[model samples]
Target: MAKLEIVSPVTGSPRDVWASLRCAAEDAARDEPQLASQLNSVILSHDDLSGALSFQIARKLGDSELGAMTVREVALAAMQADPSIVRSAEADLLAVEERDPAIRSMLQPFLYFKGYQALQSWRVAHWLWEQGRDTLAFHFQSRISELFQVDIHPAAKIGSGVFVDHGTGIVIGETAVVGDEVSMLHAVTLGGTGAERGDRHPKIGRGVLLGAGAKVLGNIQIGDYAKVASGSVVLKPVPSGCTVAGVPARLVNCPTEAAPARTMDHTLADVVYDYVI
Candidate 1:
């Protein structure tokens, strides 16, 4: 596999990302002729990233209450109302291509990755929730859960450049705040310890990585650049740049890498018993 050229959000504009996506789509069409028409309609036909994303999201989230065309219009309106949506979408695409070893092209996530699709759909739902359209926002949430198997409450504030890989069984509570550039794997939960009222969920900091099946409960903070190892049940705050693992997660060691999230390095160093309680 060729090394992917990392494109920073600061360096790569939305147009550049869109162009790359279009080029990838063209290549995919050439390689797999049968999907040419689908690719063209879903990606090449659109004028911008928002249009393509809106179309794909709407098609996936559409239901009897709202048809695909209607949902598409709503999604488009949301994207137009806030240009940040498109920008965030681009950042997310870049993050996936950069971090995910399995991904070969920018077009792959746009067309097929359920994690990407679920997150974008949540964005629209969040917009609706912000506008006081609670019913409609909940509707989108239901469809996303049913279709994608990833349940993120409409009010959860998720930052840009987040990659929720193999998103199945992932649950984020309403008050959960996932910071920018965070990478979460399958079956991870940002949830409450119990039936609490307000601000019950965990607050994940920037560039954090929550490994597969990790359950972070309550209002504790997982500090920036932290790593929660796979299947760990975290109940307390984890300091920045530390690695935690176990049923009730404990600090195993301080990660040497500045941002383990970006590196996606799951391996831990020799356990520093001094740090463990």
Candidate 2:
């Protein structure tokens, strides 16, 4: 990857993101001669972000039922119909580069990160779901899970600029709604506790941060800018701007960070806890 000067995910358009990505890919190819072909194939060859995304996803998800070309057509149709998917992809790519210190280039995430790839593929699956193509949508979902280990249902509505770190073992149930700029780590489950139907699963607000191994269950609301600490099992509603931790997660601190998702801070506040002998 090229020397990653600070790239803004919020300020630029998708076209800008594509340009930077191609620049970075060119630099990476030059830096590492062995990767030139892969870089050229994935980044330099494409005209825009959406075309690259469709090709990459199809290459990964294609199977006996749907070949790479057919899947590419499906993804391309969805992206062309609703351009928001590619826009969201751009946001997601920049979000990873912005939030994850490990990421130095947008090109790396756009080409290789399973989290970004999974989310973008899910966007196509989501479009399919919205069009009442449940079977094909589920096919995309299953392929995504099998390939990336991130299982987000097609019906789950996710917003833009979301950062999903590591992207392993993250399970988002049906009817779940994740707001814009939210960040979640590996092994996170936004699910329900009971079999009771209709609108089960959590509703995460904008700019919320869900730590690794966090389990937020039921149809409860996790308010905007709230932080769910790692390994915490949250069963009730979390107030906005608060931080919750532990089993049946309680408020560890109120008015934590204004935007914990962007900050990516997971440290608990200094507090004394009573323990009965």
Candidate 3:
């Protein structure tokens, strides 16, 4: 894997990025003292700039604990865990550029795209969880949820090629399982039934499209190629090749053939391509 050349496009300086990142780190530490101490354990060799830009970003955005962690620490950690996180973010930026005519001149992904921050954060939490550091992992996850209005439990299993749109108010429970090529809109909840423990959340198969405000509760299975309509409350397992909608979500349309996996090629450039002139 190639080394990541992450520099602030605004300053065109790697050093400035590092300085800003440190400042952000300090601010995050101040907010979540315990997390700050733990992070310091890992980044002891580095200097604390006190006014780390990432921390300021979190503060400015009114992020909860989880959001601050995403910008301050988790993102960089993710870059270390899987270079693919960086690659995917870069690709998404390019895609947004290609598709959205308005974003041709924008330069600050760090400030604007929570999706990038969320994915980067997830990489670190996922790695931590794998290493049996659930406490720290859960702390980071909670921080992300507090800041971004996006809640993805550290234990939730999510495959690659996953796209989360309008990320605010999105929640994925601890036991939830999502497969590859899944696309979800805003206000979606892949949650559990009641307050039960252990594998109580929904299991989403591959190539599923969950519309905005869709809720799949309990230990139900959403088959591959399934579509849950907007504002639906699904309480049962859906068969493959079907589209379900409404409260107690029922099959609305059963196509002869299930849809293929949703395309995951949309780059960030494409999404932000349409910049407001």
lDDT of 1 by residue, 1-277 (tens): 1112335754563337887899999999999999999999999998878888899997898878899999998898898887777777888998898799898988888889999999999999999999999999999999999999999999999999999898899999999999999999999999998886988999999999999999999999999999999999999999888899888788888754688888899887775543552
| Cand. 2 Cα-lDDT | 0.88
RMSD of each: 4.0, 4.1, 11.3
User: For candidate 3, what is the lDDT?
Assistant: 0.61
Off by over 4 Å in 3: 3-111, 256-277
- The total of clashing pairs for model 1 equals 0
Which sequence of candidate numbers ranks them by TM-score, best first? Answer: 1, 2, 3
- List runs of model 2 lying over 4 Å from the truth: 1-15, 272-277
* Candidate 3 local lDDT, 182-203, one digit each (tens): 7777799999778778879999
Error of 3 at 108 (Å): 7.1
The C-alpha TM-scores of every prediction are 0.94, 0.93, 0.63
Worst 10 contiguous positions by lDDT, candidate 3: 268-277
Ranking by lDDT: 1, 2, 3
Q: Deviation in angstroms for 264 in model 1?
A: 0.4
